[model samples]
Target chain A: GESVGLHLPTLSVQEGDNSIINCAYSNSASDYFIWYKQESGKGPQFIIDIRSNMDKRQGQRVTVLLNKTVKHLSLQIAATQPGDSAVYFCAEGRDSNYQLIWGAGTKLIIKP
Target chain B: EADIYQTPRYLVIGTGKKITLECSQTMGHDKMYWYQQDPGMELHLIHYSYGVNSTEKGDLSSESTVSRIRTEHFPLTLESARPSHTSQYLCASSDFMGSRETQYFGPGTRLLVL
Candidate 1:
């Protein structure tokens, strides 16, 4: 069963600091990846996405890095804020029918 | 903003009750998906539809069923809700925008089987 998984269950960060969330995927056939931010009692929101051909992609204050060699993916958020606290999840997708494989989320906690 | 909507944001029902979670999207997307997620857990795909009159089960084995009679609406029905079915249901829709298909999600419905 090919799946996506996160390295940490929770991450505590202070305001104005940079936060990094790591993910590992088992499927080599996956070509696209996405990061989602899910707040309490809400659905997951799109954050950033990266394709396998590229190594890094940046958007606003968020950046997504993909390493196909190690099958690793990471999301970095700059200037963490209280509003940035949420559960972050990484999803992997293949070319067949565009079905996405989800990873267990990592809780991001911001300390004021 | 995405035009996806889900009804009954929160639900608390007894065991063996029948329940249907309604999901509708005005984005005119050809793809729709249903996912079940527990608190602080990963989302499991339960069902999905490629288009109107097309429905398929996802990676997860779920007791619920879904119908795609209309392109903009996809509803999931549970014949007998049990304690194990207590979870959050999320609906999403995506257009056939070539290779990069970004899925827009709706506010989820939280279910509690008492």
Candidate 2:
């Protein structure tokens, strides 16, 4: 019964604006969370990741926030550009295994 | 960039034919995985291997079989390809550093069974 899901299927944002994608998970025992970006016809690329003990983590142009109380995770992208447009997925890892449970991806669209 | 690679970036095959999806990584990662994804859908783990000769089925039940005979190569085979097996197969690898090790992925193989 462990599953991860996104709050929205698509998000449209103006170029240079910020984008926020949300994810929720049902397994409280999951200790690791990761964010991935998948371009069309390509595999999921690792963007950033955070542990259960951390509430927030930042990358070059992205940030991942984890809220354990509500079982929510969010990825924030700054200065959204056309090249930044892609499907973003959030995954949670079980403590006993290395496999990741993926969430429904959120498609980020950038408008000129 | 990740050094992972998948062969036959796109494949169109007839039903009942056998097919193998090749995946290789030059990063020397100890963990490798195979995931299935439909168009505009999330990924589902089909198989994984912690090291050579250690293969395990993932959460999703898949008819595809995988072998880890070498450290850099993990291939998945479909004994009989079916229309229902049409999907994109992604290969990923990660080191056994810790729980939060980042997974690097290859460009994936898109298979269409006619």
Candidate 3:
């Protein structure tokens, strides 16, 4: 479930710099992984989650890195702010009864 | 103020009519969700409920339909509207009990089935 091509790809950080967003997932049993923050009209707010035996996880300023061999997943934003711009999603799951499975969103622009 | 509410934030119905999209939560969550995005796409789960009247059906095949009597309400109905059913319709709630439960979203409900 990964094929979205219109490329809204853009990430220009600067406010205080430190923003990285990258994702590549295709389920390898997808234990659990989440990071979402969509702002334009809102409705996507959980911003940090990691499972799959844990590869990395942090919160508050955000940070979630998990690489199950290469299924890759990353989201690090510490300090950047303009309210943190918008669109940022990367989710996968196979836990808590399953529900998440999203990624094709990465638009965090805040270069002031 | 734990909240999650969605309503007619914006609508423009005209095709076949009959639309209902309202979701509420005062945080007494018992798991509830419904998602469908279309602008930048990716986020498709059509329905879910793990409490009250319990309902389930998600994975994009949705003509719309959901209900959960009272656990803070979970409504989504389309019965008719079309035009591919416009877009944006999100409502989430979580805390399916114990162990790290996260998912609290609302502030979405933008339909335009014209």
Highest DockQ: give the candidate number.
Answer: 1
RMSD of each: 1.0, 1.2, 14.5
Kindly state the number of residue pairs that clash in model 3. 0
Per-residue CA lDDT of model 2 for B34-79, tens digit only, reads 9999876889989999999999998778799999999999999999
CA shift of A4, model 2, Å: 0.6
lDDT digits (tens) for residues A1-112 of candidate 3: 5431213467888899899888888668767777878889888887777877889988888888887897788888998989999988877766647466787788888988
For model 2 chain A, give the 10-residue run with minimal summed lDDT: A92-101
Q: After best superposition, candidate 2 residue A20: deviation in angstroms?
A: 0.6
Docking class of 3: acceptable
lDDT of 2 by residue, A64-92 (tens): 99999999999999999899989999999
Candidates sorted on TM-score, descending: 1, 2, 3
Query: Which docking category, incorrect, acceptable, medium or high, applies to candidate 2?
Result: medium
lDDT for each residue of candidate 3 in B46-113, tens digit (9 for 90 to 100): 89998899999987887889989999999999889989889899888987423345788898988988
Model 3 chain A weakest 10-residue run by lDDT: A1-10
Among incorrect, acceptable, medium and high, the docking class of model 1 is: medium
Scored by lDDT, model 3 comes in at 0.82
Query: What DockQ do you compute for every candidate structure?
Result: 0.79, 0.73, 0.30
Candidate 3 chain B: 10-residue stretch with minimal lDDT: B94-103
